[model samples]
Target: MSEQLPAPDPARFPALDADPSWVLSVPEGTLIARIFRAGGTHPVAWHEFRTFGPLDGRFDPHPLPVGEHEGAGVLYGVLERGRGGGVADGGALGGAFAAALLEVFQAQRMIRLRDGSPTLAAFEVTRPLRLLDLSDSDWIAVAGGNSAISSGDRERSRVWARAIAQRYPELDGVVSASSLVPDARVVALWAGAADALPRYPAALLPLGRDELIGVIDRIADRYGYLVL
Candidate 1:
């Protein structure tokens, strides 16, 4: 395996020379789809920053001392526009299902139905969101980073997120291409924007349900993933 990139140094990294035009605006009422555990944190809750490592989320807040930095939260999701209940490309899965499936079970390549009872939830944002678009190469350059922000080492990406959060406090979060899904985009929202999440998800489906198993089976068949 290639050596991992070192984390970005706050003092030595290039300055964040950002532009207002680089911001991506998600209109109010845009539905965001997520695969989460129903028994874990609420679907709309911002996950508090707690750990720092390669396994930590790419855009989770830097875990500094409580007083050392602005306390932050993060929510990861994908847009709901094209996630209709249909499998395209004959047998290949597409849209949020494939994106979320590959992302969640990437390590094991096994879809475990009972573990945490994984559920798919879709919710609408109450207000428009202004997000840093890291998917744009130009924006990455202006943000003092590169494509690593989307697909490189997560440890380094988290450091880059810290710098961006410090520089652009007004931003609700960011949008980046999914490392596992080439054609998919994923969103990471900061905790300060919790007001945007609706009280309840507009749609929810527990993967363990008997009815959903057929769909899951098809995904496994297409991708050669094992379902447990």
Candidate 2:
């Protein structure tokens, strides 16, 4: 179970309103494929994928086998118009984020997103990912700041989050405390877990394909949300 915290207050997050309104789940394989394909061309994204850690705000690239990031989920996040630079909706972005079910089969992989210059860098979590998701919910607000969102007691949050997710898969990505952005509240799980994880065992994510689909379906029924 997670530690008790104050109930969420949406009022504190006025800034987030302009942030990403919805999240599109990308499967682990997709990200691995992206990393693999981009390794030659986009070495920056690939290296960032290899040694990106959010526990502390720093880029200490470490080399490891590609299998290390096996269970990681590559999130092709969605952003709508009129929010945070009015990033447009659909197009390459839409096609990139529509794989909630494929993401479930992700084994021992996890990814962390960082707002970098002209692009977002995907950092690989060393810990075995227990759960992860994309959402506008304010359940996991930890502190306010650009770096605070990514480096606070993130490991603690991940452990607690994973336990909760195991019981309620839909809640897996609902409430993560780790932050790699200047300001972020939602969570994404298991696309880089294997690399940093001590074991090579099959990825044991909080939710399977069916459970993730349910969460996706529920969110889809709501307003201001979309899978792609």
Candidate 3:
């Protein structure tokens, strides 16, 4: 049987009332975007710090993505902006979603262990990853018929619309990212404008989209956060 993991300590993120349910080491290139894929909910295999991203040929005991490796616990931080009225759009779901949640965990000052290490020294997660059923439709809505557009099936977008409506009736008529994640208590923590939205010109952006040193200007104007 797999070992039962320990849980996070409350003192890490004071803003959080309880310790994180899962402590994860995030890979590089995870962006907090507004992904609205239509269809069935996506499943993410819980990650191990070592297996979180890629191997650095194992010679150095660290991974190739040395720069982006960071650690964090999960939380249901309130979704501030959904799809409109100047709020940041809902964050992307799936692997990106899980990584986005990690951003909040890394924000804490106490356990800043993401200093380019290949493997996390130790960690804990309260719940069984098997129990986690994460879905993009659960927290985000489509921005347009093309929100979930796919080249695979020309009618895939229509099918997804019907499915989304049938699966999540409440999200019907939701056309913007803001409208989708209303009152969404996402796995997140408090952050400055960096995590909020870009406020300056893209050319002036140093990292362009690194949540740690980046910002989204006037959240309402745009919401997609996926790097690619």
Candidate 4:
């Protein structure tokens, strides 16, 4: 039988309380937990520090069971920030977060496959200030749809949207980097600006129609605004 993990220490790793803040670290992993103002009946909100990688890889996705909760459909992403460009810094955190996200996806059974593979894309989270500042932002940017688009892939996008909708219900909408700059800007404006979108802009928007569609395909849960 698999060994049961050790029980967490309340003194060291306290149970999340109202507006609780704590740090957790495993050998190669670290988690920063913060409790935010509860959105619904639940007394607390949680944000974790983790990373993600492709499903073919060793890591398993985290568990996030879908429920009739208020914040069930919000999708989460990492926002990396730092002077160095190595995985050890913010990159590692992004991977860890992705891994956790996968677990949640698995728990919710939201995985969708197109060619016998998990329809998920891994991204490195970054930010203009500290990577930790991600929790404070109203929006996040999800990059790397260009490659998926070039290959005409939809598996990754479908699964991502389903998972996000299943998990964070509070998410208002999604903004794709692939949308025409002017068009995306208009949607952003309609949504009350970038902060109103679920994710923000960090990297250069992907070029070409295929790449743009690829980004949108991965995030199919949101309304698509056509530039033309």
Best by lDDT: 1
Cα error, candidate 2, residue 37 (Å)? 11
lDDT of 3 by residue, 111-223 (tens): 22232211111012221221111223322111223222321221333333333333332211212121133233232211111222223211111122344222222231234
Tens-digit lDDT track for model 1 on 29-71?
Answer: 8777677765644322222322322236778765554333444
Off by over 4 Å in 3: 1-81, 85-107, 110-228
- Alpha-carbon TM-score of each model against the true structure: 0.79, 0.27, 0.17, 0.22
- Candidate numbers, best lDDT first, in rank order: 1, 2, 4, 3
- Writing each residue's lDDT as its tens digit, candidate 2 over 1-228 gives 434333223344333224343223333322211112222343443323332332221111112232343232323221111112110232232222222222221222222111121122223233333332222333244221222223444443333333433333332133222232222223343334334422221222222234334543443444223333
The 10 consecutive residues of candidate 2 with the worst lDDT sum are 78-87
Q: Tell me how candidate 3 scores on lDDT.
A: 0.24
Tens digits of per-residue lDDT for model 4, 1-228:
422222222233212232222111111111211112223343222221122222221111222342233222233332222223322232433333233323323323342321122222223222111111111222222211222211123334434433433333333323232211111100001111123222322222222224333443333232232221
Best by TM-score: 1
TM-score, candidate 4, is 0.22
Model 1 residue pairs with clashes: none
